[model samples]
Target: ERHRDMRRASSSLLGLAPRLLSGPRLCSRPLPLLAFARASQQRSGDAALALGEIRVADATGSLGVMTPKQALALAAERKLHLVEVAPNASPPVWKLLATLPVVEKRPEPPKIEEM
Candidate 1:
């Protein structure tokens, strides 16, 4: 009786698996494509800067629209990184972010003492 119940449950789960796999996903893009897009973005800081013009903002509030060069200059002056917050906006939105540092840090090689 116990074995029969387990078999029934397993069969039901197997039947539901197909539906679950075919159902609408939370994200429109597939998992692998999403991962690839994220990886590409991380690999290049200029991904957002590639745009002609963007809406820049800071800690206080919006800084208005400006060229990528100008935004980058402003961010450099404040020791912050110019990061894209919204890519879908009309001009795309960029913000001066000091919190998230995107620079890569490489570890120093070990040194050996001479005899």
Candidate 2:
């Protein structure tokens, strides 16, 4: 009937095929994408310098291979931290880094009244 045909035609948008609506819905539904709402993306720093031998960079920009314990001891004697700078080189290079001193707030001096 013409009424049935008009109802079918009115249900679908103009120029859009009726088969598209009757088929499985894809655009109306969300895709299978994951949301990292509760996920943690941060990673802790891992020191490549261990007990094994590694190349260290001195003040003169020269490289020398030494055990991590020796380098660490040398850094400790100098009051510094041995940090690995180059990890992709033929031999990893280490550099000495100075740690910042923590500053604390001190109580104000007692007020003195002079006559």
| lDDT tens readout by residue for model 1, 69-91 | 88877877899877666677889
Q: Which ten residues in a row have the lowest lDDT in candidate 2?
A: 35-44
lDDT of 2 by residue, 27-85 (tens): 65323322122123211113544436678765667558877777777777888766655
- TM-score, structure 1 vs. true: 0.49
Displacement of the residue 2 alpha carbon in candidate 2, Å: 52
Worst 10 residues of 1 by lDDT: 28-37
Q: Give the TM-score of each candidate.
A: 0.49, 0.41
Q: What are the per-model numbers of colliding residue pairs? A: 0, 0
Give me the runs in candidate 2 sitting further than 4 Å from their true place.
Answer: 1-51, 100-115
